[model samples]
Target chain A: MAQQTLEVLQSTDLKPKPDSSELAFGKYFTDHMFMMDYAADKGWQRPRIVPYQPLTMDPSAMVFHYGQTVFEGLKAYRMSDGDIRLFRPEENFKRMNHSSERLSIPPIDEDLMLDYLKELVKLEKEWIPTEPGTSLYIRPMIISTEESLNVAPSNTYTFMIILSPVGSFYKEGINPVGIFVEDEYTRAAPGGTGNAKTAGNYCAAYKAQERATANNKAQVLWLDAIEKKYIEEVGSMNVFFKIDGEIHTPVLNGSILEGITRKSVIELLEHLEMPVQERQISMDEVIAAHEAGTLQEVFGTGTAAVISPVGSLQYKDQDYVVNNGKMGETAKQLYETLIGIQTGRLKDPFGWTVMLEA
Target chain B: MAQQTLEVLQSTDLKPKPDSSELAFGKYFTDHMFMMDYAADKGWQRPRIVPYQPLTMDPSAMVFHYGQTVFEGLKAYRMSDGDIRLFRPEENFKRMNHSSERLSIPPIDEDLMLDYLKELVKLEKEWIPTEPGTSLYIRPMIISTEESLNVAPSNTYTFMIILSPVGSFYKEGINPVGIFVEDEYTRAAPGGTGNAKTAGNYCAAYKAQERATANNKAQVLWLDAIEKKYIEEVGSMNVFFKIDGEIHTPVLNGSILEGITRKSVIELLEHLEMPVQERQISMDEVIAAHEAGTLQEVFGTGTAAVISPVGSLQYKDQDYVVNNGKMGETAKQLYETLIGIQTGRLKDPFGWTVMLEA
Candidate 1:
C-alpha cells in the first residue's frame, strides 16, 4: 500500500476560541479541517488539513441527487493533566468502515485515519475544551462527488473531518428526559441501511423527532419496522432498560445502529457485577415491567450525550413514567463511570481511553 | 402566497447542439438551467434561469449530513409540426410539492412553478430532440442547504431544474427486458419515504440494481419490505401485469411510488375498455399464474420508458420467461399509445399534453 502524506496549510486568520462553558454542539468550528478525495482512476489521495471553508462542486453532483453518504461522530476530551484523550476512537473508525462497506464507499485504513485524526487534534489542541462535559466533537464523513444523475455507486468521493467544541449536554446536571414512542415514521427495516451510519437513516428520523418535539418530548423511540412492537432504538441512540435488577437492551439487530456507547454501557454494567443481557425486548414487555414495578430505569446511549436517562415514555397518548420520573442509581453510576473513563478521571481498568502526548 | 418574480441571466457562450441521433440520456445539458432559493425568513424566492455551472456551498451543508432532498422527473417533446409539448407538467410540479412536504421542504406554488417550467422549456425549445423516442428530460430537485451538522429539517433549501437532451431508451425499437427479483435488500418500508421521490430511496436501491445487473438483468424487481413477497415496483418504475385479459398492478400501498405514468396507463386501459385492477399481487401468485398459463404479460410504467415489457424474471436463481421473451400485444399497444400521446404524434383524447407557446 502506498503511504499517503499530509500537506498542512494553516489558516492565516484565526478567531478567538469560544469558552468551554459557552461552546455549542456542531457550532464554532476549528480553524482547520481535514479533507481527502477519491476517484476510480486515483484512489484515496491528497490527504490534507486545509482552512475550514465552503466547498465548490457541480450542482448536479451525485451526492445531491442520490445521497450515497455516510458519517461518524466522536469526541476528544482534554485530560485533567492537559493531555488530550480519546475514548476508543478506533472503534468509531472501524464502524465507519462497516458503514462504508454497506454504502459501497471505499474502505479507509483505520491506522492512517486515526493518525490523521490525532494530527488534527494536535494542531487544534487549543480547541479541546477543559470544562466538564466539554470536548472537541469530531465529525468524519464521506460523500459521493461523482457529477452524474445515473443511479449507481459513485466512482468519486470526498472524505472530510471537521471539529467543533461542544458545550455540556446537561447544562445544570444530568437529568432524566421524556421520550415519545413513534408509530408514524419507521426509521429503518430489516435488510435496510439501519446498521450503517448513513445520511438517509438520519433524514428519515427528523419527522419522528419533530413530532416528539411538538409534543414537548426530547426524542422519538423507534419500534421495529416489521411488527412495530419490538423496541429498536431511541432517536439516534441505542436504548437500554434495567428491569428487575437486570440490564437489558435489544440485541445487535440489523435495523438498530450498533452504538459504541451502548457496548460500553453493557461492559460497564457487567464489570459492576450487574447482570447484563442483550435480547429482544418488546414495548409490551416494557409496559408490563413498568406495570409490575420492575422497570427500574431506562436510558439511551450515544457519542453525543453518552448516557441520557429516560424519565418517561409516551406511547399512544399514555405516559409510562419510569422510577417516578427520576434518574435511577444504575443510570447515575453508569453515567459517572463512563464519563469519568472518557475524560481520563477514572482508573484505567479496561484500557478504554487512549491518552495523547502533549 | 405572494407571486414570485422571474429573473433571467442568459448564457453568453452557447455550445453546438448535439445531433438528435447522438443524444444520450441525462448527458449533455442545455445552456441554461432554472434555480431558486428558500429560507425560513424569506420563502422560496429569486427564481432565475442562469448559466449552467457548478454550485459552491459549505461542506457542513445539511443535505450532505441528513439527506433531506427530493426530486421530480418529466420530459418535453418536440412535435412533428415544429412545436414543443409537455405531458402532465402540472402533475409533476404537484408531485414535487408532495415530495417537498414529505421532505419538510416549503411547498412550492404549483401554478407559478409550472409557469417557470413552461418558460424554461420554451427557452430551451431548440434543445428538445426530434427523434422518434427522444425528448428533453426535465429534472427538478430540492436540497437542504443549511450549513449545520445537526440532524433536523433544514431552514434553507435550494430548488433547481436542469434539462437534458436524451437518446431513446430503446435504440432500435421497444423490446422486452429481463428483471431480477430482489429478495435480499428491501427498498422501502410501509412507514418510510417510499412514495416520495427522495434521494435516499434512490440511493438505497442502487445496491439491488447492481446485483441485478451483475446477474444479466435489466432491473431489480422490489418486493414489499415486510413480507418480501408482494410486488412493489421494478427499479424506479411501476410494475404492471397482464393475466389472461385483465390488467393488474400493485395497489398504491404506502411503500409503492405512485407513478403518474402508471395512473395514465390504467386510465388508458379503462378508456380502451380493458379491465384493470389495483391490488396486492404476490410472487407466488405470479409464479402460479405463469405455471397455470394465465400470466400473459409483464411490463413497467414510468416517464422515462413509458411502457417497458418484462421478458424474464429471475427468482432464487430460477428464470421465468414471459411471453417466450417477446413483447406482449397489450404492452406494445400501451407503449405506442403513450409515446404517441407524449410526442404529439396522436390525437389528444385525454388532454394530457400541454403545448408550450414558443
Candidate 2:
C-alpha cells in the first residue's frame, strides 16, 4: 500500500505552555493534535495535524453507548543535550493493533503509524519538557464514531494522538507505598478483554480503586477473577515480586495486560544475569514466603510510574511489610537504568530508543 | 430535596417522521432530546429538553478513553386510543441508577428524571409510530465528560435521553434464531461490571458475536468465564431454557445482568402457575436434557426483542433443535401478552404500563 500523505495545519493561536514544575499528568495539552478518520468504505483517510480542540459528534455515536474504543500511552523525552527521544514506541503501536483486533477494530499500519508519530513529535518539540523528571505524555486513541444505536461493530471510527506535558510520577524520591489486595473485585479474567488496552478495562476498575483509596492505600492489587487468589496486576501496572534473591511475575495470562515496561524489565534482568520467573504467584504463596522471611520486595511497572515500589501489602486485614517498608535493590536498579536509557543518559544497547530529527 | 425545574428549548425545525412501515431500529431520531449535567459541586443540574443535535466534547474527555458510561433502553408506544404509554419506565430509571452506582457515577433523582422523560416524550408524541409493532425507542445514557487522562472516576458527567422510531423486531412474525454456544470469549465474570448496563459490557462481547456470526449463527450464547460450562447470557440478553415443561434461567449471579424483561417473564409465569426455576443451568444439563428429548424450548429476553426464541443451539459441533426449530407455545404466549399489555389492548394487572397524557 502507498504511504498516505501527512497534512499539517499549524495552529495560529498557540496556548502558552505551562512551567515544567507546574505540569501535572494529562492536565495540559499542546496546541496541535494528530487526527485520522476511518470508514468501512474508505479505510483510513484524512490524516492531518490540526489544532487541539473539542470534537463534534452525533448524539447517537456508537462509542457513547457501546464503548468500542482503544488507547495507548507513551512518552517523549527532551534530553539534556536538547534532542528528543522515544523508548520502544514501536512496541506500543504493535500492541495497539493487537488490542484493536480484540475490539473488532481495524488495525493501522504499524510502521506508517510510527513514522507519523515521529512527525507529530517533531512538530511539537517545543512542548516537550526539559525538567529532569518531566516529559511529554502521548495518548493515541481510537473511538467508534458511527451515529447508530446498533449493538454491532461500528462502520466509522476516529483516531487521534494528543500530547500532554506531565510532571514526574515520583515528584519526590521513589518512596515505597502501600497496596491493598482486592478480593471483591477482579480486573480481568481469562476469555475477557483484559489483555487489550481498551477503554472498558480501565473504568471497570474504579470501584476497586475507590475501595483502595478508602482503605488508605496507594493502589489495589488485582487478583484472578475465578479463584481471586493468583495476582494479576496492581492498579494499572504489571506487578513483580522479589522472593529470596530472584524476581517473579505473573505469566502472560489472557486477562493481564502485555505492558511494554514489564517486558523491558524482564529483558533487562536477563541481560544482567539475574534469576527471574514468570508463573502464577498466588497470595497464599506470598503469605507463605513472607512467613518464611523470603518475600524481599514488591513493585509495579508501567509507562507512567516505570517502577512503583510496594512497601506493604494489606491482605485479609493484615499488613505485611516487605523489605522493611523500603525500596528494594532490584527496583532501584531497574528504575535508574530504565530512566537513564529513556532520557538518553545511558547507552541504548538494546536499540530501544528512537530519535526524532530537529 | 426540592425537585429541579426542567427548562425547555424546543427545536424550531422539526424532522419529518419516517413512515412506520420503513422504521428500523435506532436509525431515525426524534427532534427533541432530554439532557442533564452532573458536577462534583452542583450535583445534577440544568435539566432540560433541548434540540437533538451533535455533542461537542473535548478530545481528552474521559469517556473517549476510559469508557465510564452507562445506558438504558425502553420504548414509548402509541395506543389504539391515541394515547402514548410507557411500560415500566420507573423500572428503567431505577436500573439506570443502579448501573450508575456500579460505574461510580452519581445517581440521578429517579422520579424527577422519569417526569422529565415523560415531558420530553409528550413533546415528541408526533414522532411515535402508530403501526402494530412500531414504537419510539427511548435510549437514556450517561457518559463521563471530564477532560483528563487519569484512570479515576470523572468528576463531571452528561446524561441524555434520545428517542428513535423503531420497527418491529419480528417483521415477518417472530421467527426463532440459531445460537452458537461460545466457550472461547466470555461476556463478563464475577467481580466485573456484568450487572451494570455499561457500555463496556456490550462491545466486549463483539468478538464472540463475530465468531458466532461467522459460523452462520444469529447470536452467541456466552458461558461463564471460569468453568465455561454454565450458561450466562445469549448475546446481550438473558437466556432461558425449558426442559421437561419447566422454565429455567441462570440465577442472578454477579456476572449476569438483571434484565427487566427477564424479571417480567418470571413474574408473568409465576402468575400463570407455571414452574420456573432461577438457578444455575449448565451446558451439561442442557445437553443431557436435549439427548433425553426433554429440552423443549430456548429463548432470550431483553428490551429490543422482548422474547427472542432460539430455534437451535450449536454446541461443540452439534446442533440441538429446540421445539423442532419453532417458537414454543410458552414463548409465543409471553410475547403476545407482553405486547398486548404494552399496547394497552390487554389488562395490565401488574401495573407495568405508565400512561403519558396526550
Q: Supply the TM-score of chain A against the true chain A for every candidate structure.
A: 0.98, 0.99
Model 2 CAPRI quality: high
- For every prediction, compared with the true complex, DockQ reads 0.74, 0.90
> Which lDDT tens digits does candidate 2 get at residues A1-358?
2578989999999999999889998999999999999999989998889989899989899999999999999999998678999989999999999999999999998898888889899989999999888999999999999999999999999999999999999899889989999999878889999999999999999999888898889999999999999999999999999998989999988999999999999999999999579999999999999999999999999999999999999998999999999999999999999999999999879999999887
Q: Please identify model 1 stretches exceeding 4 Å from their true place.
A: none
CAPRI-style class, candidate 1: medium
Error of 2 at A226 (Å): 1.1
Count of clashing residue pairs in every prediction: 0, 0
Residue B163 deviation, candidate 1, in Å? Answer: 1.2
Q: Which lDDT tens digits does candidate 1 get at residues A172-265?
A: 8887999999987999988789999988888788778889999889999999998999999999899999999888999988989999999898
Model 1 Cα lDDT, one tens digit per residue, B1-358: 4886799898899979999888866768889899999999988889999988888888888999899998989999997678898999888988888877777778998898888999998888889888788899999999999887777899999989999898898998877999999998989998888888988888788778879999999999999989999999999899999997789999998888889999899999999999689999999999998999999999999988888999999998999999999999999999888988888778879999998988
How many residue pairs of model 2 clash at the backbone?
0
lDDT of 1 at B254: 89
lDDT of candidate model 1 versus the reference: 0.89
Report iRMS (Å) of candidate 2: 0.7
